[model samples]
Target: MFDDVIQEDVLLEMKYVYDYVKIETAFPKYATKKALQKYSSPTLLFAAENDVFFPSKLIVPRSEQIFSNLTKTVILQNSSHMQNNANINKILTEIEYFFSN
Candidate 1:
């Protein structure tokens, strides 16, 4: 029964409300301690210094505590959500090392 959906109406009313609820719901539901504990095997977690989604210092410690075989964590000071620049290079280096020897 979804019809007559105007672009502006969706964008202005439904999308804003949906986005707000989604943002509020996502955090508490997703990143739980038990959820983190499920990760097994050698894991490499890369967190950016400027990331809004995941804070490096906070998440890194949890990862270390959770994963028994967590190989390494690379915190890129000059990086954001997307890994770019020398930090990305360093991450690649770490990944290479972890896989190699």
Candidate 2:
């Protein structure tokens, strides 16, 4: 089980992501654009700074264009895809504030 968690198995930024799920970058030009167009709810996107699977640099830019009703987009600095070691206080603060309004 643990052996399956090898780096070679992990999907890179957006490479070959479409084979599994619809995603943008280095593949079809916004293949999920039409899918997102139907979702008009106020959304908040949080990207991890050091996440290779879905890095902030790659995702946030595309999200800005895709999510028409984005309430806010935040890049969690010094963070990664998994939040095992993430700054909990900061995360809570952001979530609290976003929903508080």
Candidate 3:
């Protein structure tokens, strides 16, 4: 049950939250290393293989630098900036894996 389901105010707030989620997914989570504390909130990064803007070459390194509890970095093959996500099965399984542990 949601309040103000389609009202302009609610929609604007929703858009802001959605935008934040989309942006945050690109990089890693907050970083704090007590000399590599070894455990932090697990972050799963799904990068589009054909995405020129945020290629694995850039995402991977940036992730490693910040996320101490990096769970996995999955490159979605054949996917681009606006992916229909052909690898739904793989992606879902990875999400399961992330949640299970």
Off by over 4 Å in 2: 1-31, 84-86
Error of 3 at 98 (Å): 1.4
- lDDT (Cα, tens digit) per residue for candidate 3, span 21-50: 655445554455554576567789988766
lDDT of 1 by residue, 22-82 (tens): 5544465445557666666678888776676777877788777767777777787755654
Could you give candidate 2's per-residue lDDT for residues 1-101 as a string of tens digits? 11123254343533466567765557455636678878877788888888767789999988887778889887877677655324556678888998888
Best by lDDT: 2
> Judged by lDDT relative to the true structure, which candidate is superior, 2 or 3?
2
TM-score of each candidate structure, all chains considered together: 0.57, 0.61, 0.54
CA lDDT of every candidate: 0.67, 0.69, 0.68
Clashing pairs in 1: none
Positional deviation of residue 81's Cα in model 3 after best superposition, in angstroms: 1.6
Give candidate 2's error at residue 1 in angstroms. 17
Query: Candidate 1 overall Cα lDDT vs. reference?
Result: 0.67
Best by TM-score: 2
TM-score of 3: 0.54
